[model samples]
Target: MDSTHEQRHPHRVVVKVGTRLVVDADGLPRRDFLNRMADEIRDLMDRGIEVLLI
Candidate 1:
């Protein structure tokens, strides 16, 4: 058996964006915050990071 044939470590990660961060305290959805979060996610994807959003 070859020792170098082991499976690579998992790099995938799951990120949960809470409602509190996506919405205001008054339970109103915020577009500005959502847009910023989207941009950040895009940046991470550009770096080959696997992100699973729930």
Candidate 2:
């Protein structure tokens, strides 16, 4: 990725979520939040957007 102010071309985006956010405070998986996130990502994908998550 370039850091120049006048040249901003992002061909891809990566979103990183920590385990605490993706999981419960107790360390359990959060299905509801995951589902909601999936929905939102799908919405973006439908618009021809590409997302890379880790």
Candidate 3:
């Protein structure tokens, strides 16, 4: 069910990205994963959410 009330978004978001998350087991960087993450961050910003990527 959907609420009849207004929806609110977060004022800010802090993302702590682990090196291992964006890297392969053999130590190679994962470009696809990074691109997806970047897109997500951009979406957040579009919704007026301040993103701090670390």
Best by lDDT: 3
Q: Candidate 1: worst 10 consecutive residues by lDDT? A: 1-10
Residue-level lDDT tens digits of model 2 in 1-54:
457732454445577866757675556568876777789888778766688998
Residue runs of model 3 more than 4 Å from their true location after superposition: 1-8, 22-29
The better candidate by TM-score, 2 or 3, is 3
Per-residue lDDT tens digits for candidate 1, residues 1-54, read: 354543353346587877657575566578876776789888878878788998
Q: Between prediction 2 and prediction 3, which has the larger lDDT? A: 3
TM-score of 2: 0.55
lDDT of 3 by residue, 1-54 (tens): 234333354668899887767674556568876877789999999988899978
Q: Candidate 1 has what TM-score?
A: 0.55
Give the winner by TM-score.
3
Evaluated at residue 15, the lDDT of candidate 2 is 73
Evaluated against the true structure, the overall lDDT of model 3 is: 0.77
RMSD of 3: 5.3
